[model samples]
Target: MKRVVFAVPGSLDTPTGGYAYDRRIVAELRQLGWDVECLNVGEGFPSPDKATQSAARSLLLKVPDGQPIVVDGLALGVLPDVAGEVASRHPLLGLVHHPLALEWGLSAERADALHRSEQAALALAREVVVTSPATAKLVASDYGVPAERITVARPGSDPAPRSSGSRNEVPHLLSVGAVVPRKGFEVLVAALATLVELPWRLTIVGDLTRDPNEAARLQASISQHKLTGRIAALGAVPSKRLAGLYDEADLFVLASHFEGYGMAYAEALSHGLPVIGTTAGAIPDTVPQEAGLLVAPGDAGELAGALRRVIADAELRRRLSDAASAAARTLPTWQQSAAIFATALEKLA
Candidate 1:
């Protein structure tokens, strides 16, 4: 049987965009008749300590000789030494969601180290698969990977029932992402505070435990803005619950610092909810002007203005919502993505 090993970081069940993409791709690959073996190298990756690094190296080394091995970029980017050794012996492919060096809040030295390491590791890959065209371009320009060897299989979105906007006086806003600095939930809060006169409630759905300190800080910010009563920080919920939130939302917004592929924005469009986000990274590619409003990243005033325009103008919101639903129909499916990924893997042979 045709087979391949997919080595990923721990917490395969995590309710994050990258993890979700991994899970869906793996399932579709198996259904397509490829024996996909998932190898869970230890977690705490992209910043793993010595012990974790050792454990990950050992696990990766155990794969049979000459077998095709695909490593998640979260793990692959930090292990250049191991990648060089393995790629010499096996058909190694690196699956990158985004470059780790682009993450927010990294020290200059650390970012440079990560960039150098990732560039070296990706250099050894037979080819690289990225989640979006933006990332493919980054891998080529920033990571020194050849553009020809990169394949872009944008994350797929499942069709969803159109959102039934809150049939009430107050509109409900939803934002989904990990409660981390990079996700920029704090920026969203700050922007929302400026529009206190508008009757809108914001609900942020994400893994609060991923960064407890950030969660605490966000809570404090809410209290400081006296928006504790208007904003609800519902930590990560199951897929069903998230769909329910989507159905209840009038608009979707996330002021992320950057995104390789903004899966949440796509999901919102699938649910027929108009989007309001920053034009950071792949966001503009994921969300267009017809479906939503986009502003400069970290600009609280701009975000507030965009939100006000959407909230106060029901006709405009309705038009954007219809456009979102139309765009959703054109999104790639998991099946199509899997077919492209399978073809990319076939090239490794």
Candidate 2:
């Protein structure tokens, strides 16, 4: 049996797009007969404390010589020394969702440090696998990784029954993602505030615990807009309940500042919900013009204008809904993504 070690920073169960991709890909690989060993290096990665750094260093150094290993880029990107040691003795593949340095809301110094460390770590890998072509290109151009050495395996979406959609006279808007600065929920709130005269409600489903300060500010924004009753921020919910939300929602919206793959937008398409997203990152790549309307990342006026147009015109909404469903039908499956991952690993081995 082919064997490989998959090293990641945090719990496999963390509720976010990147972690979910890791978990699903790992499970699918095992189902296809790979003996995949999961190693959970302690958290606080990309900015680890001394204890976390020591533990992660010790674990990577102990991997058997000549073994093939895949390192989650979140952890591998920051540990240049450990990655260098591992690469000298074993084949290493770096799985990158996005460059940590490109993430929104970071101190300039911190971003620069991450960019340097990640480049050093990625340079040690035999090859790199990214979740989107945009990321692959970014890694090549910005990180100095060779274009030929990077492979793009887009995130997969499962088949879902078309959403029944909202029956209410007022449309219900749904947004799914972590409530952090990168998500641009503050922008979403501001945009929605402008359209308050319209009949609609918003439900934000995401992890509020990831950034307490950001959450506090978002709460204040909601309060300032006096949208306390119309907008609800429900922290992360189970998959089943999320599916229910998708089914009940009339429109799916997320004003993310950036995305490596924009998995949520694809998932919304699978549910046959028209999407409203920003043009930043891979969003334009994933959300087609026919399937949804996209505005500039932080442009509140544009977002509000787009919302008003979509909500006022039922015929346009229906057309977009059909386009979204057609787009979803063409999305790659989890099994296919796993096969890609397996093939990439085999080439390295």
Candidate 3:
């Protein structure tokens, strides 16, 4: 039997995009009869430190000597030397959720270092899998990876039922993601401030991370904008409950600074909610124009206007709702993503 190892940062319980991708892919591969193993390299394994490098090297040694290994980009990009060490002995693949170089909040010097590291890591992979065409292009242009060697596999959403309630009430807008700078919660708050008199309520569903400074900054901004009454931040709800939230919401909004695949946007559409997102990263590809609106990132006025238009015009909302539902049906499931990934591995085997 052929074995495949998926190396990633943190455990399956980690609430980040990379962990979600790893969990889904591993489950799918097992169903397809591939011998799959998952190794958690803990948090911050990719830092530029001797201890982190040693830990990464140790992780490379644990993979079965001859098995093809799929290293998560979070772990792989930080430790390019480890990829160099393993590629010679194993058919190595790199699964990138998004390039580290394009991550939000990085300084120019840090971003350049991440870019160089990712470029070196790509050289060591026999194949690379990315979640969107936008990311695939970034991998090619920035990391120097050939376009042919990269595979675009989108993430999937579980089926969600449409909310059953009276439609005559005021519209409720939903935004789901971590309370980090990259997720652009501040942008959403700023947009909400402009439409204070509108009869709409905004619910933010995401957990605040361990970073106190970010949490404090966002809280201060919320107060400064006087959005306390209109906006509510409900940190991390269970998956089962999220469906209900989606059902009740008239629209879904994601003002991310950047995203590799924007899974939440897809999830919202699956629940038949129209979307509003920034034209950053892969959001434009994920959201069909007919299903929702896309605006420039950090443009509070544009986001505010879009929100107002959708709220005031019932016909426009109905049209977008129908279109979003149709688009959601066309998305692949985790099983399909696994099948595509398995086919890629079979060729290399």
lDDT, model 1, position 210:
84
Stretches of candidate 1 off by over 4 Å are: none
Model 3: per-residue Cα lDDT over 197-241, one tens digit each? 778888888877634577777788888998777778777788777
**After superposition, which runs of candidate 2 have C-alpha atoms over 4 Å from their true positions?**
none
Candidate 3 structure, TM-score to reference: 0.96
RMSD from true fold, candidate 2: 0.8
- Per-residue lDDT, model 2, residue 49, is 91
Q: Point out the higher-scoring one by lDDT: 2 or 3.
A: 2
User: Which residue pairs show backbone clashes in model 2?
Assistant: none
How many clashes in candidate 1?
Answer: 0
lDDT at 107 for candidate 3? 92
Candidate 2 lDDT over residue span 171-247, tens digit each: 98999999989999999999898887899999999999988999999999999999999999999999999999999
Per-candidate clashes come to 0, 0, 0
For every candidate, C-alpha RMSD to the true structure in Å: 0.8, 0.8, 1.6
Model 3 misplaced regions, further than 4 Å: 45-49, 165-168
- TM-score for each candidate, following the candidate numbering: 0.99, 0.99, 0.96
Query: Cα lDDT for residue 269, model 3?
Result: 84
